[model samples]
Target: MYKKLLLLLLFFKCFAGFAETIRTDVLVVGGGASGVAAAIQSARSKIKTILIEPGPWLGGSMTSGGMCILEGNRTLASGIYAEFKNHIRELYKPRLGYDTTTNAPLVFEPYTGAAILKRITDTVKNLTVKMNTPFTAVKKDGTGWEITIMQSGKAVTIKAKLVVDATELGDVAAAAGVLLTAGFDSRTDTKEELAPQNATNQIQDISYLAILKDYGRGIDRTIPQPAGYDATQYACLNNADIKKMLASAKLPNDKYLINWSDCANQYPITSDDLNPENREATFKKAKLRTLGLIYYLQTRLGFKNLGLTDDFKTTDHLPYLPLIRENRRAAGMVRMVLDDIYTPYTRGSQLYRTSIAVGDALPGQHYSIPGAPHINYPPFPAYSIPLGAVVVKEQENLLVTEKAMSVTHLVNSSISYPSVQMTLGQGVGATAAYCIFFETTTKNLKPRIIQGEILDFKGMLMPFADIKTTDRDYRAIQQIGATGLLQGIQKPNGNSARVLFMPDSVVHTAEIKPFLNEIYSRAFLWFNKEKPGELFTIGNLLSYISEMTLRDPKNLQDGIQKTWKTYYKFTTGFDATRPVTRREFAVLANRFFNPFARKVDMSGKFIN
Candidate 1:
């Protein structure tokens, strides 16, 4: 009996040793929307990637949180976000009458969104996904990361070359010893005019979102009155019309996402609430607030038929995760501020050239927090996200995305949208791939090389509303726009705004000459010698290109004219004397001189 017991113990110990360590090129913690996108992009880039999620479903906000109504980037669809939007459209358009042609906001059921994401992730070759796995600990192992995760009630170790902190609340980054800033910023610290006099540990309001489905007109689907429910808590909803409120976030089918802030459902959070030990109790309070709002709608407003939907597969009908608007932000190489967005072109640091993602949402705060300062600012314009914002300065081989990116609290108001988060994820994924392929650290990697990889994957480096992904000159326009050679014009469109490239407009020498001189040394000599007119003609452009490349002027012009109609598909006949439009100039100059090839550092200064 003693011999048998010793042999059994030895067998169990050997099995534990064998199943202990798993290796991968990249390990992405938290399978949120950004985490999923990062894993997908890294896997598609031909790297062995593993994504781990605490919950069973992917898509933190849009799926588990039940906030399926996508905001911002309606026209700027690029990369995995575009692919996800297409999949949502294809599945729901015919059956649920979803409009696919127009640029309307896309909405869907939360479960369908998660299933679609699962299907998309399954198609990628070098990716491995583990659900019901929670991150436990992380430590540096030489140049890589040695992570411990809880799976099937046992601790499993993972060794990864790089780590991406895509957690909903920047948990991984915090664990990795990255400096984090939470809550409001002071005007003195961020140098923003709109910030308050002092900083606080108060973050944006979070909502425990509930999706309501109409069972039928006669059915009474109202939930039982929740504990600690108080009617006066939702006094703000007294004047709100029930129909109008329900219509605010109506999704596909007869469902509505109950993320209303007016009903006092938006719960305020502080640094204390972010503690893992206290998070559950904190979330419970938020859930109770949402239930109070729901009770107000059902008992008082006479909407008993609209009840919580079983979208998240939770025992309680509420969403599995809360819709977190803000969280702990990592301190990266560059901290993006409001000035970066307000005046991207004229900003002292040309961070626009290092753009990896784009966002056009206006900056505004939820009015749920009492004593929250109200600062009125100008309409927000589309802005580029610098690569440095996602790359951690203190930590090596680490990247943070989603709401945890390195941005000022003021700037986070605009970039926390789901679309921007996904694009940011794709950008960091490409960044990780580049570092792995070249065997370099994050500090040594070039921003333009990552931008090039994103462009090759049909990602938008700059948000140009008029330039669609299907356009033949999309790459040219995006690349040129990144170099600041052709800046976009911001136009107010109803309540929102967009940055138009105005490709059809005629190019003026004065508009581009300043940027040309900044980029090319010979451009100054060409402008001095030619003394070109206000209207830059095709002949003038060709002469400038000749000066830069030292090519034969006549030969360059002849080559451009030949391909002008055949390859470029320009409807207008090639003319040497006529003024060239922005589209014509962008295409020709991009093809011949290739100014976009010039490298820029993280500060947007030309390095070579």
Candidate 2:
């Protein structure tokens, strides 16, 4: 106890006086897509929010990294992400010929994206954006946190109720002494079959994403040959198929988001990218690599008109931040594995219930060794990012978002899209605000509460691409699908088969009984075996439910009526002989198994 007192005294002594001290309800470390979204949502919640960004601008990859191409399913994006996309459309509709109705042109100039983010934040009350500020240190100060930031060579201290590790590399988590997994986690560590036998710090290549604009014909805007320019490095340009892929990188605005695809713009870096001692040197090397690639494209690849765009002023048209694909991921409550997307989880688990965000990026291996068999992961169902995966273990008020969340390397490949990051950022920020309002830690907070709030915010917790919001049973279908109890039937064809959720078809007792048995340890009478093609009636469901709940089927009339009332609000006129629709089964199954089913409006907007 006395030693602890000494340590506390030392902590106070270290931050006894700083150049400036600021206090806020939340402190966001990075101004990336996730960080910006978090700050926006937190401030929108009427809390004192402060965002500290190392660069002069906001929008990390979307702007600073020149990743103007919007990847992932934009329809699943909600809240701040949706607003940002709409703002982009409004800003570029007349000038760039964007369709105001739909997101026709998913790409934009980097500066335009940054300016839009700045414009939105300027209007948000109680939000402070500290540009050109880098986070240096973080320590727990009583119930809150004290973060030391370096701004303009002056040390600034910020005390906040919560700290969000929105840094692209999980910097805040590192400073706060949180357990982080770097590079490829071992198969034993993540239980992913694709994971390396031994954890290696050799991460996926970081891209200094360059924005090159086409100047039509007869325009010579080619860059001068860069120093150490090697013509042989880009020999893949000779391959007709590879050249076609590179040519297809052109955006609608005639600007190309050149990051990868055999052009050799991506540079493989080790964990040294985050090393404080040699990080700057590593970044410089990466920059030179990209600059060389640009020169090669102009001089050797016969693209003389294509030159760097003037969108990024801070870095002289170069991206401010290198797009680091994989980094130090925080070891949160749930570490997402390959099976989370490829295989279904156990029914009724928290992972199945507490979805905060969703992503469905097709997993591609563009950075690995050439001729290495690329495992093209088939377009998967839009899977959820569980809330438990964002809450950092052993930390009271810290949340991990963006590419730094607790996910295996294999899983991160599919989930690290910029839109998904923004969606998750909003959820994390909202969760922080809720925590402050209720005066509770993230661990003690209930998953149902978080999930409900996210849904209310127009943020999607489930990503069913086939199911529209206006569908008659969107919410019920979503809730049941989330429990891992329902899965789409896969086509029996070859490797090109697509998974389909046949929503309108009548479900059979034999088809769905196994799922029910797995979720609820129920016993069924073996007197009669139901036929494979027989439609599962409402009466058949009620009898099975009765046996599952350990109640006699003969005496379950009142109980069945009560169950129907609880879920469907049906008072009388029940038709037990009627065939059960997929929608009806969804509502009944969700209401019975989901603990927070009471919070959902079973027959509201979901049932259009």
Candidate 3:
């Protein structure tokens, strides 16, 4: 008997050396919306937490995903949601260049966004955040979960008491065999009016959101029609689905609920949504076509195709990655419904005591999925959120994030807005952190207690500004205000105005100087450049930028050269100091985003 027991022990011990175990109190996956918040909260709780993001940049939708607007969290939506906005204010305020309007500090650049996230996250303890580490697979391991992570071309195993799947597509939960519902569940799985009866695990449609850069003048700023660009030769651009909006020109804008006239240089430019199953055929085709759409429009009409402008006149083309507007949502314990926003709750009772975060996103009408209902926003009084929605019903170990979470289809349509989701993301982030600190599941937390924790973590739950005019830096203008980048308030007289922020207004080198200095962008190089005071030409800027910064200067240089040689070679250029419009730089800006690149900066600081 003794010999047999000793042999068994030896057998168990034999595998120890090769285990390569990474033990953490909390393992938060996907560092976009929810994961970032969750990881930050976990670390702030002073518990050991590891954040694994498949992408290079941390700000999933806002930065790398390039969806800059804040979503969800309203006045009634407090907790972790409030804290994220506050961080934006505290960190990005001073760096916002002088605002032409309220002059509130705003950070328009994407790379700057990454830097901000890095700064806030680096301050936490027992937290290891690694990019390009996608969670490949997951499995149940008794009380905890065993997570497999792929990083730098190798697979590593991790053991976490709590695992948060803040992945963009509810990856881990699905991999772990969690029961989930995808696409718009009309009456089939859910009694949602906007859903279809055949909603059989069909996922909601995902679209790629891209930013174009048009520097006012230059042939390079223009888009040469796609290889087959022809007014007569129409395919995807002329598809009845998209053409339906094209005929109305205002349809896409209306569905998005934005006055496009105010978007400045903003126009359509995208590749394929990264999560698309047909990445090579479909996604790649979409990206080229997005630019081609602008090219067609420009060639048809005598105009240019400008890229999305974060700050500075430089071309910021395709989004570092595709924006997954909607994805697989988990089946949670107590799903949130649209009616729940104005809950049919007993007066003194709360709908959910596990309130992890808050939001106020009213769904827009973008019908990628068939039979999607058109939703109009009539202000529902801002409300609170519970932790039940964060827990994957079948798999208690995972938490859904980004565009994926548990919500009644109708309810999701409302909260699915970009601004509101950010708030919700923060809430779950705090929940993950709390669970790590207390060593418990989010299911066990009380909403009031969670609220307290969120407050303690310094996240605020404030209502929408009576005067809302957040700039490129978002609420960041208030945080970095000391640098004098911002002038006065978010809007003139500190009141909300009918202002459509022009994307191009933020891109001046003069404005960037303050941002670069405040964010610690190679101070030595800032002063010691061979091409000091050169015009804001892509060629000129690339010439002196630190090699460390331009990990592959030649590649970026070649793109710019090709673009310039092809387009901008003849157009007049803008003065780096002068304020310009997106329409002016339309051509050059349109191609800034790469087809497959995540962000322009190799350092992972989000590029504008």
For every model shown, the clashing-pair count is 0, 0, 81
Better of 1 and 2 by lDDT: 1
Candidate 3 — number of clashing residue pairs? 81
The segments of candidate 1 whose C-alpha lies over 4 angstroms from its true place after superposition are 1-15
The superposed Cα distance between candidate 2 and the true structure at residue 429, in angstroms, equals 1.9
Cα lDDT tens digits, model 1, 1-608, are 99999999999999987789899999999888889999998888898999999998998888888878887788888999899999999888787556786477878898898999999999999999999999899999877898899989999999999999888888888888888888889999999998998998888888999989988899888788988999998887778876887787888879998878745688887867967888999999999999888888889888898888877677778899898888889989999998888788888899999998888667658757678776676777888999999999988899998888999998887788777788778888899888888888888879888888898888889889899888989999999999888888889766566889999899999899998888788888888899999999989999988888889988988888899899999889999999999998999888878888898888898886
Q: Which candidate number maximizes lDDT?
A: 1
Q: Write the per-residue lDDT of candidate 2 for residues 419-507, one digit (tens) a residue.
A: 77888888788888778878887767565566666666666666665565556556667666655456655443333233345666667
Q: Work out candidate 1's RMSD over C-alphas.
A: 2.0
- Give the TM-score of each candidate: 0.97, 0.81, 0.61
> Tens-digit lDDT track for model 3 on 129-183?
9987877778778768988888678778899888877776667776787776655
The reply for model 2, stretches above 4 Å from the true place, is 1-19, 90-105, 151-153, 240-247, 346-350, 368-379, 470-473, 484-502, 510-534, 538-576, 587-595, 598-608
Candidate maximizing TM-score: 1
State each model's CA lDDT, in order: 0.87, 0.71, 0.52
The segments of candidate 3 whose C-alpha lies over 4 angstroms from its true place after superposition are 1-19, 71-107, 187-205, 227-280, 305-317, 344-349, 368-372, 376-380, 460-608
In model 2, pairs of residues that clash are none
